[model samples]
Target chain A: MSALLQVRGLSRHYGQRIGCEDVSFDLHPGELLCVVGESGSGKSTLLSTVAAQLAPSAGTVRYRQRDGEWLELGTLSEADRRRLAREEWGFVTQNPRDGLRLNVSAGANVAERLMALGMRNYSQLRGIARSWLERVEIDAARIDDAPTSFSGGMQQRLQIARTLVTQPRLVFMDEPTAGLDVSVQARILDLLRGLVNELGLAAVMVTHDLAVARLLAARTIVMQGGRVVETGLTDQILDDPQHPYTQLLVSSVLTT
Target chain B: MTPSYNFAFLDEDTKRMLRRALLKAVAIPGYQVPFGSREMPLPYGWGTGGIQVTAALLGRDDILKVIDQGADDTTNAVNIRRFFARVAGVETTEHTVDASLIQTRHRIPETPLREDQILVFQVPEPEPLRTLEPREAETRTLHALADYGLMHVKLYEDIAQYGHIATSYDYPVLVDDRFLTSPSPIPKFDNPKLDRSPALMLFGAGREKRLYAIPPYTKVESLAFDDHPFEIQRWEHRCELCGSAESYLDEVIVDDRGSRMFVCSDTDFCGDRRAEAQA
Candidate 1:
């Protein structure tokens, strides 16, 4: 079957620095693919390029529309990209601070995506925000509290809430559980897994944590030196890594 | 001769209009009052709102501090301070504790403000419901009726999908626990400063032509759900320059290759610390 998202010869560079070179991938609907890489592996650059946050220097990222049309992400105008981002794509950043508008109330933050998509009913928006807060294990009483007052785990959950509120078909998460405690990280990973399964949302998650990838992604891609080193089923890759880099990563996880 | 710009770059008529709007803002605390705004020399979306407020409030006795994203030396802040110095002929200080009036574009000063000091915020859009209900007329009716059903629904949907309320900046709030207000674009980190602040807080939206104020000691609550409350971003790292843990920080790109150093965004706050160390 044709993929929901297709990238062909995708490349991005920051002047002399190679962000990503000759990178390509395909993501199917309801599938969670985790792109694992180290600090300078261009993992973030790849995600940002796909999310239209960063313009690619070369190649194409095409998204299959509901109407069976294929639209090149880079070719779309700014307004068009914004509309797509609001209507079809949800992006979650590594830092909850960058992902959300921290000054707004949690309810406002959740409601904002809907508002951006032109949903105009205050009572309904509040109800939705309250419901989501409960789902994220946040007490309903603090819906009006600013995200600034939230703990790191809660903030990441809120970022997830903000993106998911719109019910976009595609969700891109960059290090969703990076800074949270181990327990919080597990809970968030579990939450994400349950939600993705229930909503049938296609997701591309970028993380350095191999365990996190195994828990949430069906498929895994290992990247090193701004290039994909391996790609396969999460279980297969974890059990029998092909590339030396993936082998090292798997070995390191086992030792620790 | 092309008429040279006024001392502060804003024309006299604009200053007069701002003066009138400011009086009304002061009179009706927490009320967003509208005005017939004039074109300012500065861009409409920039610090024109704060500049107008400063122009109206400037007096020989007052000292001013302007900060953007909490930094005093940011280009925008520097320009604003220079504007006041040229037009108002008032003293400008980089010490947040010493300033009588502060015109801030984004982040609030890190120093705990005194009752005598007043904070003026430059707002891009004053209406909290603008993003929800694009029609100003409809939103006004909703506000008047205290109807906020739409906001709740959006939050609920977020729960259904992501399991949390997602928002980062320009967070909404309940002013006086009644009207929903936008606390400008200050990071959620600074929203706590709005609650019962000793200093009076004013918001001006030049493009939207609105002015609002929160009187000293008034209650300002950020909007949230019972289960999921609002939050601000916290870093395990402290400010590298001032060694201050409490201040808002800007992540500065130190190298062309993306190396970063987090420093206090509030220049006046940093300067005061440096001065204290020297002392």
Candidate 2:
């Protein structure tokens, strides 16, 4: 019933240049919010600022802890912030190579978060990693193989598995399906939707693809020139747009 | 002392600066303290770090012992001992127990050290995460966060490939339950000897300009998994000359016919054992 994440008037600036301005949202448990826009429209800046990867120029981002305490992201020490990032939160990058440790095996990649949280038992970690790999449709037989040896799709799936293995409550994804072939992108999108729904995860995803927003996000926010143009339910925004930017976005996509 | 050189081959001011850094290193117990490293007469890789530490700690009455790869007669060992003898004019000994200060490379003495004794190690690299994460800034952040998951990944890869941790010398260790440190290329066989030891252990890296210390009776754990635990190297044969089976052994080629014999890596320990047998 309560909001899991609260953002109030979040703004980030690159000196005099505006990155994102006056963005406010509430993400509830088991909810997915997608921010869709053209490139350089502040979608990524909003995500990174909210995720505490970049400093906010104005406003506060608060997250509810597992213990039911509200933590102000701006006030947390560097150590506590890093701990929260590794233990409670997960970030899935656009490139799987950036998200996954290339030198380590797939199993180690999945088990890295657990190990970071002090899971000392090797067999238990390996077992969990193997099961997660299978759940993500990666062959369990390839657990010991380097992620570089995997195809792009498989690598992305492995990255998702690595992020979700720790069972993080909220995940931040930045153009996760970007740069993949269309078929591969469709498969990854489907896999992501299933996993997000099954795990009841609250996620904030940044994507330029409106179709991706429609497929994954329950609530959608459309941005233009670092400002929110329109926001509503995914279906309503796609069907009946109120803002000029929203109408243009709906018309620009190739609707079947 | 030699007329041309100051005591211990270093100026009084340099020794004082080194002493300050050594104090801070000892106080933090495994945290690397940065110091101004001066060029020594010896080459950089050839125990320059250990020599500086020795020069700083050497006293008028302190007996010095230097060893390279557990041998007292190796060129590195002999030259370092002679270097100290000529500069500081201090007493130098080959016996481990008789010496008050021990400067070593790549090995720990087989004989257990006493509380009064101090062990100095020549370190080529000070940072344990250097090979895994190339960025010094990122590695420092990892250490500050105590996030050592990258280390486990390395061990995990070793297990996946060779079925166990293949790292023999220079294995990683968690010092004082805080800093992940490099144990200066000592075989994993000696890793256990580092835990709760009576002697003080100091590590110096001249090339890296860092120094760290482990006071007596501190916890030193070699990184390993629960199922894939840490294990040491073992030999099937005993030392050929001393007939001691417990010490670390080195394989020696005996003849042109491909016959080989195992000998104790610690020459002093092997000699003492042979002397005891003769007695």
lDDT of 1 by residue, A1-256 (tens): 7799999889999999999988888999999999998888999999999888899999999999877799999889765786788789999988999888775678788887776565555567778888988888888888877889999999999989889988899999999999889999999999998899999999999999999998988899899988899999999999999899999999888553
Error of 2 at A184 (Å): 0.8
Q: What is the per-residue lDDT of model 2 for residues A143-166, given as tens digits with 9 covering 90 to 100?
A: 999999999999999999999999
Model 1 TM-score, all chains together: 0.53
Q: Best candidate, DockQ-wise?
A: 2
Worst 10 residues of 1 chain B by lDDT: B1-10
CA error at residue B236 for candidate 1, angstroms: 54
Q: What local lDDT does model 1 show for residue A252?
A: 86
True lDDT of residue B138, candidate 2: 92
RMSD of each: 17.6, 1.3
Candidate 2 clashing pairs, residues 3+ apart or interchain: B170-B185
**Stretches of candidate 2 above 4 Å error?**
none
